[model samples]
Target chain A: MSTPKMNATGEKSPQTRAPLPSQVVKEDEPILVAAAKAGDISAFETLVSRYERKIFRLAQNITQNREDAEDVMQEAFLKAYEHLSGFQGNSRFYTWLVRIAVNQALMKLRKRRPNQVSIDEDVNTGNDLIPREIEDWGPSPEERYKQSELAGILNSTIADLDPPFRIVFQLRDIEELSTEETAEALGLSVPAVKSRLLRARLKLRQKLDRYFRRSENQ
Target chain B: MNCKTLVVELEDYLDEELDSELRTSIEVHLAKCKNCKLIVDTTKKTIQIFCNSEPAPLSEDTRHRLHDALVKKLGRPRA
Candidate 1:
């Protein structure tokens, strides 16, 4: 097999992807927000149209339950509507809405009666923390990428991340927000965001390493 | 920063959030510490792979339900 070319740093030459256009379409969310605040429903609808998907995804990521996510999404938008007049435009509308969604989702989690698992047990007994003989998790990152199953496995591994870490990773990773933006959205300090993101990525790597190791051994 | 400090700052370094002075310190350490370099590389690749996964699309029914609820609560504004 012809090996993929390595760059100056001895890493695969990174493929460039087009940047996502900024999500805020209208230069003036404040204007739309102002109209909505005045009970102009059209302006409110415009605001909703701009942010529904992002709000939905944020809720879903936090709740990890489709039904709960739907409820959180609805409640968040409704709350935003009720308090529309209160918005001072101190932050981007999307950022404010994200806070609302995240708050709603967390409240839902708390109300649901958390599962019986102990926090200490969950942390100490986490899959990666348990010591096991290192298995060669496949040929290496390069070789593993060639496998058809790797993608599916990787997807599942991300799902397996703890919710807090997963949200941070999703915001920083999938959303491509800068660390500062993510911290602001999630109500975390940049350092906290950095640590959570790193821990999340490390956990994911360990999980994939386990999968590849098993595959190689078979 | 030494390997120990660099290891702690691995995430900040990878995220490009480290201040230039601190970044310079870490880069100097990375040049000497192969282990720290590997950790950085692996962490970056892991994040890239995780984030690059296809986003899950929102369900149509969920979208409709949200729209309906928002309309009911706020009502459509006058033209």
Candidate 2:
């Protein structure tokens, strides 16, 4: 709650000047959170700027609408600011923020389609047959050069997944959140997150294998 | 572990969620089974490619609008 020290010129002291939000690293988050909780608006704004892109993309992935995602991002940040006092610091600030962003995005989706089923209810049972014929995608020096194209294909493939699987994959693999964090954010059980992630990864692997095999044939 | 069991558990194996005993069993099976080994290796590669891929960046306009909106809501910063 201590105020940042100011120099004779009325600018923040060099030691107290916060790093640019983009330059803020993980270890600095708790300090930022404490500052924000102490009514430092700039501190909270730094948190917003740090996670804005990631939250926007998560929203976009969930809502599948650019405008809706933008709206969700704004709303999520506002909600975070309002609830900043309640953040217990038990979880990482980003994880808490992600939970809020995810809830906002899902709420937007539900508002658009009131009859949608819960994502967890549609979970795959994890008993799907493994394709016996999956071709080996051994390391190839040339394939490393096609990363951009692979990313595109991977994006489209992820988009093709059912909502439950896609969200799980986006959070776990793409965003690289831990299984527990993803489960909490999605309001799913840990086992459910693991199952959905497995199915999503297997599906993506099958698709990529087919693509590589086709390219090899050509 | 047999191929069917190993196939079913491959994802867990790769995720490191399997207990050490089961993990060792899978490792043993993978060493002797070329097809299972191939599946595991390829699946690992698939995950690597996706994880290494970057998500799309937010546009400049969106970034600016977000910042401006926050600044307005939070009030102007004091020097």
Candidate 3:
């Protein structure tokens, strides 16, 4: 048998398929969340099966360490289960779960980087929002790379961003949190979330442009 | 709107939060400004790529440990 390959993100090569996750529960999340809150173990397991991969990725992106990421994901789920009764279903369960996970990931990140004072510094880059690269990447440029290569490009670029920008971007873009939700999750004002999101998007675009640019495609 | 202002409002434009008049102004600027247009398009693509990409699968061992830990910690929930 061929040994499993590893990538920059420490994900086992996509080829060494992990045992296919069991049927991802098709039920609406609120229903599952309700059941889990009611002590229905299988319902909670279904939620776990449905979200583990995304939660793991969110943690890995924030902590940038696989083991730390795993711990964060595990701890997040445990806490979510422990606090199930408090969840009022006011927002999406996933979003609420994401809030718990982000808090867990940030705690791990803060412990690892003691000198970094805060992830919500409200940076001001007056008149610095211009795009340096002016080239078009034709439609579906990501289709140009194989999945693993594309994943590598994304992971490495995001890992380079300072934690503040990276965390906002991860929640807003990758996880599809609303601007307000992202703000609430991180304890930042809505404006602060907007500011960081703009910088993060532009910076990520500049980084990804190297490989996806029209010139690079030629 | 000039490029700097356009850039500042880029997220709002992309997210379609701008009222129509402001949105049209940005759109007009995008039509006339190649650089701004590229920035908008590619920034959009960047979001789309990450948004659509599948999360990598968890290793089975990691999956098992997560489940085992939950069960142990939470105490298997009452049936």
lDDT scores in order: 0.64, 0.72, 0.81
Pairs with steric clashes in candidate 3: none
- Winning model by TM-score: 3
lDDT of 3 by residue, A67-165 (tens): 999999999998998898999978678888899999999999889987793787757645677966488899889899999999999999999988899
TM-score of chain B alone in model 3:
0.88
Ten consecutive residues with minimal summed lDDT in candidate 1 chain A? A117-126
Candidate 3 chain A lowest-lDDT run of ten: A10-19
Q: Candidate 2: DockQ?
A: 0.32
**How is the predicted docking of candidate 3 categorized under the CAPRI scheme?**
acceptable
Off by over 4 Å in 2: A1-25, A140-148, A213-218, B77-79
Q: For residues A1-218, what per-residue lDDT tens digits would candidate 1 score against the true structure? A: 11223333222223322223433235667788887788678888888777777677667666667798889988998998888777777656766777777778777765674772221122321223222344443324535454447656765677787776877777666555556666776666666676677778677767776555445656
Comparing 2 and 3 on DockQ, the stronger one: 3
**DockQ: which is higher, 1 or 3?**
3
Query: What are the per-model C-alpha RMSD values against the true structure?
Result: 8.4, 9.4, 9.3
RMSD of 3: 9.3
- State in Å the error of residue B19, model 3: 0.7
The candidate scoring highest on DockQ is: 3
Q: In model 1, what lDDT does residue A131 have? A: 23
